[model samples]
Target: MENSVIKFHHCEKDIYCFFVPEQCPVCGESLSSRRLQEAPVSIPSPFVNGQKIKCSFLVKPTKGTFLREYDGRSDLHVGITNTKGVVYNYNETGVCRDEQGWAQSVSVPLVQPDMYSLINQWDPYLEQFSLAEMWNPQRYNETDHNCYTYALTFINCVLATQGKRNLTKTEFTEKFVLPRTKKASRYITLYQEISENYFYIVDSSQQEDDNSSI
Candidate 1:
């Protein structure tokens, strides 16, 4: 990412690989210094003690990451956060996923920070989970019984306390997880190409007619 170049696709229309070009790649519009940079990105606050971001489930790479801004398959680890931003994730050995290492984690905001803090029962339910299936490490299986199961179980527990219906894996993944991951994957691939070439361009018209995830 030298000079941090990333190609800017203009709203799924034409290709615009303006490395500060003199004119706009489309419409033959003139370029200005300020507009050429696009808009600057605002970084969010850190996850620690950030109730809004951490009140829901969080996902990060299982091991050291690379541009893994997010992805929820085998390479990713999921966790639930307390109102105070303490993450509780499960693994084969134990439930201290954070004790390992993480560069960054993207959170899913299914659970609300205010809702969790408003209930006096929330903390108790979290503590009680320690006595559940995770109590026996032998039950751990990377594919079947894993961190995702633990997090989803806690979500259902909270729903029960709130008198809401349970959520299935299909709905949770297709509705929530995939949307966020697509954005991350697109960002990563775009960056990878730009880092090498210092510029990238895409034209929707040039692409084949097909359905594909980022």
Candidate 2:
């Protein structure tokens, strides 16, 4: 069965508060309260000097219009973030680095602190893989051995080091990749839905705060 997306309402400062049908999850109260329960402790690390350190796997819609012609459909790009918050994604050009964005992401809890090292080690290999693909179109099929596969390979390698069984391509796509991509797509749709409605006005006062964080 397909996974269902979690429903939430935008709260103060754009924080998402989970909802259960007509009721709020926190306070066991009505949704009108708008007060959130203490934010769940983050998975990566607790706030250090008021800064949250996070390492995650992100599934972002491909940027720009140029590459869309290749697949004739919107494609998802998968990447992993380092503890330093840098994102590493494999693309036609090779592995690219960028700062984290407000995209769909899943926290990847490190079994050991050294797992971060394992992620970094894949960078060179991914670059090599991409280079080989550039020389041969058949090396990486757009639908099969693409960015999603690249990210999955890296994730499976990390899991293997932790004595966990590696995930098959089908298992990885069905269990992790597809679910996260669907959630991200739904989030974009929900945001547009809310934006078109007149009742859910965002406070202009928080614009600066939001931009700064981004």
Best by TM-score: 1
Predicted structure with the largest lDDT when compared to the true one: 1
Candidate 1, 100-189: lDDT as tens digits: 343355567755546635354555567678567554688889998898988888888778877899999888878877777666656556
* Candidate 1 Cα RMSD (Å): 5.5
Score each candidate by Cα lDDT: 0.59, 0.47
**TM-score of every candidate relative to the true structure:** 0.68, 0.49
- Candidate 2 stretches greater than 4 Å from native: 1-54, 64-73, 100-140, 199-214
Q: In angstroms, give how far residue 37 of model 1 lies from its true place.
A: 11
lDDT of 2 at 80: 61
Q: For every candidate structure, what is the RMSD over all alpha carbons to the true structure, in angstroms? A: 5.5, 11.9
